[model samples]
Target: MAELLVAGGGIGGLAVALAAAGRGYRVTVLERRDAFTELGAGIQLAPNAFRALDRLGVGEQVRERAVFIDELRLMDGTTDEVINTMSLGTAYRERFGNPYAVVHRTDLYQPLLDACRRTPGVELCTGAAVTGYEQDADRVTAVLANGERVGGDALVGADGIHSAVRAQMIRDGEPLVSGHTIYRSVIPMDRVPEHLRSNAVTLWAGPGWHFVHYPISGGREFNLAVTKDDGAREAVTGRPTPADHVLAQFPEIGPKAGLLLRLGEQWKSWVLCDRDPVPGWTDGRVVLTGDAAHPMLQYAAQGACMALEGAVHLGSVLDCDAGDLPQRLIDHNYALAPRTARAQQVARAMGREVYHPAGVAAKERNAEIGSLSQAELHGKVAWLHHGTP
Candidate 1:
């Protein structure tokens, strides 16, 4: 079996470790942080992601801590009317084979960690920062920030948007920060008004601004995300404005949205960024996954799901092969590129629709969406909501 090293302990890297360990490969995860903690946010895991977690035997634990939403509700910003809705609750389960769920970022990480701790071939090392790597014909070695070295048969960069290993691969390409910024925060369920806390993902779309909110942590809290177009900020800019400044931008979000922002305990800004699809995700013994490979805006709500799918597919390819290590890695990337590209395109389009809808065009678009037949709505998201193994 191959010895694998995964840099970064985010969802993608941990999934890779789980996939590798299941196949009896020796896997080590090196995380730079001293303790495992996720930033403020919630992620939606569709059926595909649930199937992937099921492969690791942690699906039940995840479900116990997450909120299972049945539908996605699109609303009119001015009228506060439900424009359109998709049945992700029962309909999705019938179409796909699993349920969609929402959870705090930490809830998603904990069960994966527990499973990794129990697996014999899996090891997790914290506070270990990977600085660079050296690859030869037969093996790869990761150099730690403190002058330590770890050797393995191959390396996977699940290190996220600021990947050091991805940097080494491109040598010439860098991520372009789309001139947009997202503000995020979460609040306790008690803080949210009773009318807004339901098993639906509510989205408010308006010109140059949009808001997303959903119940998470088994209905104990609500996750909130706001995105707006920011005119050209200088590269390497300073910190974003405080939560109050963010609240000031959304005076039209109505009572529920306003209440959520007023009650959120912490808030932060993230510069939205993405890159053109790379021709390949592997070179020799190193490969890339997740945001490191294809970062996209949250409008699609598939970031974690796509990463989960990639990990499962990568593991399945490797698990079925006993020889030709490099070719197997190449095949993994080949299978993933098309899928990631399509998802990226959809994400970009969704971002434009939500934040850059032209003039009064947003109203017309919302009307069209509300008038869509079930077949039409399902057709638009079939690729994402019902992915096959």
Candidate 2:
């Protein structure tokens, strides 16, 4: 069997390993962290992401832990009026062949990790940071920080946005900062008032900021994320941001939106950053997937979904005969680049047009959203939710 070495034990890397192992390949995953853990609070998995999870053999596990959402409501932050609502219940499932759901990051990550552990041909190694790599005509070897070299038929760089493997292969500069900051928190569902404990994903859009909240962790917790254009350009993580500091950013928000924002405690903030879509992501036997290949803003909430899709595609392409390994990697890049590039572009557009708008522009956005019928709303995202690997 062919050996596949994956750098990074994130959701994307583990999904890739599971897919590869399912296809009869021996897979080894190296994670920089000593233990596999996800830091974020929650994630929204549209039907497209669910399709990828199902193909990786973890769909049922994910579904058991996920909270199936009924609708997505876009509201005017200053007026507390919902501009539009998209149905995500049975109609959505019937149309997309899967359900739209939200999950705690750990709830999703743990199952992938457990599946990896149970798989026969998959190996999970921690504390192995990939520093560099060496590759030739036949095989590639990932160089670890501790000076160990692991050889494999192919090396996959799923090491996230600051990927060491990408640094050696593409030599791209630092990721571009969006001059936007986000404060995130997850609180016990019981802590949220009954009125605020929504079973749906709700987004409040204002002039220069937006707030989103949803039920996660099997309805035990609520995940809140607030994004604004405060021009902070540093990507700080896990720093305790006071609830007051978060509230201060949205002084003019409506009472309903304010109530949700004020409910969050012990918020953590990070500066948003992404890279421009590159022309290619494959170099010989080494290939890039997920954030390493195409990082995007969270406005569209498709970052992790895209990563999951790419993982399945990468594994499927590599499961073929060994003689075409290099070409197959190139094919993987070609297959994924266009869709991810479009997603990146659309995400940026959504930040400007939908998430943060001012005065007349905001009104116009509301009008546009309110005018969309259910079919039109579904058609707008058909390309993304129904994309093929």
Candidate 3:
């Protein structure tokens, strides 16, 4: 069995471990933190994410904790008009092979971590941050922050956007600030106005800003994310912001959306960031996965989905003999670039053109989206939801 080393024990790292162990590869996952825990509020999981999780053996566990929303609605923030609605009913499920759902980030993380612990060939290591890697003809060694070295047949950098492994391999410097800052909150669903509490992932598009809210934590809570294109330079994460400050960012927000936004307390904010996709992320025995490989805007909501899909793809290719592994890694990187890069491009465009349009442009967007039938809506997202493998 090949000794595979995965840097970062987050969802992507644990997922790859689960996938590799199930395929008979001995895997060691090194996490920098003292405890392996996820810290995000909520995450959306498309059918494509479920397809990968089902392959990695954690789909049902996640589904049990998820809130399966019935529709995705787009609204004009200034006019309070429904721009479009895409039903995630039987038709969409039948087309995509799974339902669209949202969950607490922990709900997604814990299942992957539990399965990794239960698997025979997977080892989870804490307080072992991968600083960089050195590879020769036969083996690659990960240099840790504690001044120790761990040897393996190959290394997979599932380490997040600020990955040190990526720093050494790709040397791509820092991530690009999106000039868009998002404020997030989660409030009890029961507290939300009954009329506002719908089983839908709703997005409000305004001039230079947008808002998204959905049911999460098995419908017990609602997750709120509102973003503004304010040309922010520094990268910020989980920074606390007063409710008044957040309210001031979107002057043109509609009355209904304003009511829902006003109810959110304990707000936290993040200045969004991502990198332009590189042509390749493979170097012999060392490679990258997840956000380490491709980080993009949350506009598409496909960042984690792509990571899960990549883990499944990576595990599938590595199920063969180890002698030709380097070539396989090269092939893997090449094949994944086109799809991921397209996603990155699409996500950037959504943020600039669709979500943050002005009066005339916003009306045009609404007119165009309103023209699409449910089947047309399904057709547009089929390429994303029904993925290869």
- State the lDDT of candidate 3 residue by residue for 240-341, as single tens digits: 999999999988899999998888899999999999999889888988999999998998889889999999999988888877788889888988989999
1 or 3, which is superior by lDDT?
A: 3
Off by more than 4 A, model 1:
232-241, 254-256, 320-323
Instruction: Tell me the lDDT of model 3 at 115.
Output: 88
lDDT of 2 by residue, 255-346 (tens): 99898888899899989999999979999999999999999999888999999999899888977877799999998899789889999999
Descending-TM-score candidate ranking = 3, 2, 1
Error of 3 at 235 (Å): 0.5
Superposed by TM-score, candidate 3 places the C-alpha of residue 7 at a distance from the truth, in angstroms, of: 0.4
Clashes of each: 1, 0, 0
Q: TM-score per candidate, in order? A: 0.94, 0.98, 0.99
Q: Which ten contiguous residues of candidate 1 have the minimum total lDDT? A: 231-240
Candidate 2, after superposition: displacement of residue 57 in Å? 0.5
Global CA lDDT of candidate 1, please?
A: 0.80
Q: What lDDT would candidate 2 get against the real structure?
A: 0.91
lDDT of each: 0.80, 0.91, 0.92
TM-score of 3: 0.99
